[model samples]
Target: MPMQAAQWSKALLADALAPVYLLVGEELLVLEAADAIRRRATTLGYAEREVLEAGPQFDWDNLARAAAGMSLFASRRLLDLRLPGGRAGKDGGAAIQAFCADPPPDVSLLITATEWSSKHESAWSKSVDQLGVQVVFQAPRPNEWGRWITARLASHGLSASSEAAALLAERVEGNLLAAAQEVDKLAILHQGGRIDRAEMERLVADSARYDAFKLTDAAFAGDAARALKVLAGLHAEGEELIGLMGWLVNQLQLVLRLASAEDFASQARAERLWPAREQLFRQALRRAPRQHWLGCLARAGRIDRMAKGRESGEPWREAERLIAAMALPRGSLSAP
Candidate 1:
């Protein structure tokens, strides 16, 4: 039913046998998991990978065209229908349902959605999970972020000393996308396999590329001047305010998770936390209020929606508001 991202074979899973591959989740890892599924399907003679967006404007017949033509390149074909949350809707949903009712028996049907919620149900996600595989790319919590960071670095065939690992984890927290990037940069600077603390501190300490991380650090430290400076610079550098708020939310969540959990091992057990990130989590726990992260999420969500053109907010000003709130001392924020 639920398959680990690593356990599922991309090629085998993408073969012509499985008709529906429903990748469900909003997490970056989940998105990458879908990418893996697609790549594997390529090896199994899946010649086509077309994206069909489902909206009122979309044509039901176009859904069929995703795999309509016979491939001169290969026999097997892949029809990727980017569903409305990977669920069947009015037009394409029914077409997809019909296709599933009596599958093409040749083409592999792949469906992907942002987040799999408990609310909606449709023939598309159902069939995908039943016939195909659901690779979970759940977001790693703050506690687990460290472990994931370690594994990610290890995967790149790189190693960091225990202290360096902890520092990196602290600096990056549990944000995998950011952590992965840091790893990539460190890998580039590392020259060889070994990456030490001075190197990590030197690379991460720079606020140019990773201003948000630095800003959050300043916010936690209650250094308003530093936080504002980073914020203004980040804004100038084309960094979005809502995005920074999102990063703050992520850090806060990790801190709470690590603090509440029985031990640092919870991060590893629950979210695959790394050995080096314990101190960072501990430090975060000490500096910020747990609710600050949640508040940041709510605010960021609204700001993010507005910025996306889905809702309304002066994006730049909203970021200033968030930064102002974040700059407040941990003991300062109160229940609202």
Candidate 2:
């Protein structure tokens, strides 16, 4: 059966051994789950380990060879297969199915992929599910995030109030790795204490690494200073200019769509705007007309070209100009 990372502990305790294991996700949670499996394999006398990374140039026969080979040093072995592209192509699928059908008793197969999609639901994946265990790691939703943070803190022998957990949820912005790291830091700083919002604020002040969403928040709030500040921070942090431009284009398109709608509330619902963020979009709508927003998006497109070397200008400078154009007062537009 397919299980999440949280259910792994109980599931592992109940059924600790399996012929094959498939872990699929892009989050660090997968790493934890894989570590658990590795430890259990070691405990079960799979003392020898071999890793096979499948890539464009990978040979499918190597998988069959590894399974059939015997370890000279150890009686039992662990075959760790890393599929970065998440799919076993035609030959790989056949090889995997063959291995699953008659897995070597001395070898325990551990497979990890960075992602799993509908297209990956091939016979190989099905064979693994039938023969072994599959664990998937999914990110928690916004409302469920506070509880996640609380549980993470409790795991480190630390606890936080509901307000503090909420603050942490906001600071990390749904990044589980960041939340886990922050909990570790808090455990060191304030061990054996119940954390509150003020303490959270002090600890998490510099933790807010600027991202596209934060940049858009400043621009939509009409704070030219903060918007430019965030843009500079992003550039300094080595954020890709093309990704930032994509975010700006997306947000401006949303604004353009909302502006054209007769009922903005209905439009917001259609756009799936979170309740906390709807006010920011509405404020941005009031700040600029549809034409102006379109112009900003057009400028973003030019920046995209510059980033791809299709144009002849500095991309970062162009992005700063676009952000300034969006955040400036209503009468600030002079020319293209």
Candidate 3:
């Protein structure tokens, strides 16, 4: 049955009667669920656990040893095998088959790895499916991201304004890592209490990785086309032109911060500005001038006016004009 990381505990209430359970996925939350189950089982008297991580030089003999070893500590033994590559080799496969043919009494074997494509699922995979529970992990969809965020917040005993959640869903745009970071930030600041939209606005607006943060790179590179391309994507996403202007201003601020870095390694110190891509920002500042930021902001202002006015014009064209002005050298264009 399909299950989310948060729901695994409920599913396991009945399924825990089984001696073994398997989890597989790239989602970090899924992996954490698998670990939680293993710990719970360990507390419930399944001792003598053995974990095999599949990597170079991993051999099948370990499985043989696990199956054959007499439990020195507890009545039941648990094997948590992590095969990131998804299958064992010839010798390993045979060992696995033998273990499944007649798994020792009170010995539970759990397996985990990345999911295999239909055509690529290994024989051992089928064998494991027939023998035990298999939990597969898939990334949450766009609609599901909001639910995941809410679930995560509740898991920590927290709540948020519906507007706050809505804005988070809007700004983060289904990026799990970004969502996770935002959740963590809120959790800490609010102390697991209620979070409001004002707090969300204060903390997160532009996606640090891609959103309005990227303006100057396009400008400094003198590629008006690329600058406009970035703006076009943001515009298509329904971002307000004023919102873009605000982020552009923030990016200009980062340029000032970057220039203040004392030396090479001080690039790390520059993290205070962007905090997300300090190294990249430092590199961009190497060839760009602090004055360029003011220039970019001026151009962004004109674009904002065009967007707010009844230009009856494509926002992207105004964005292109903005990029063109920003891409030129500091004095290349007069101030707005």
Global Cα RMSD, each model: 14.2, 14.9, 12.7
True-vs-predicted CA distance for residue 276, candidate 3, Å: 16
Cα lDDT tens digits, model 2, 1-336, are 677677778766743468899999743666557767877877877778888989899999999999999789757888989897889899989988999999998788899986877677788999999998888777788899999899988877888899999998997787665566567557656747788899878766533333566688678768789789888987887877877777788888888899899978669879876433555666678777888888887888888999989999899997888888888747454445
TM-score of each: 0.57, 0.60, 0.56
Q: Model 1: how far is 81 from its true place, Å?
A: 1.7
lDDT tens per residue, model 1, 148-178: 6677788778887766788988865555554
Candidate 3, superposed: residue stretches over 4 Å from native: 1-7, 15-17, 205-336
lDDT of 2: 0.79
lDDT, candidates in the order shown: 0.63, 0.79, 0.63
> Model 2 shows how many backbone clashes?
0
Deviation of model 1 at 205, angstroms? 2.5
Model 3 residue 232 distance off true place after TM-score fit, in angstroms: 23
For model 1, the local distance difference test gives 0.63
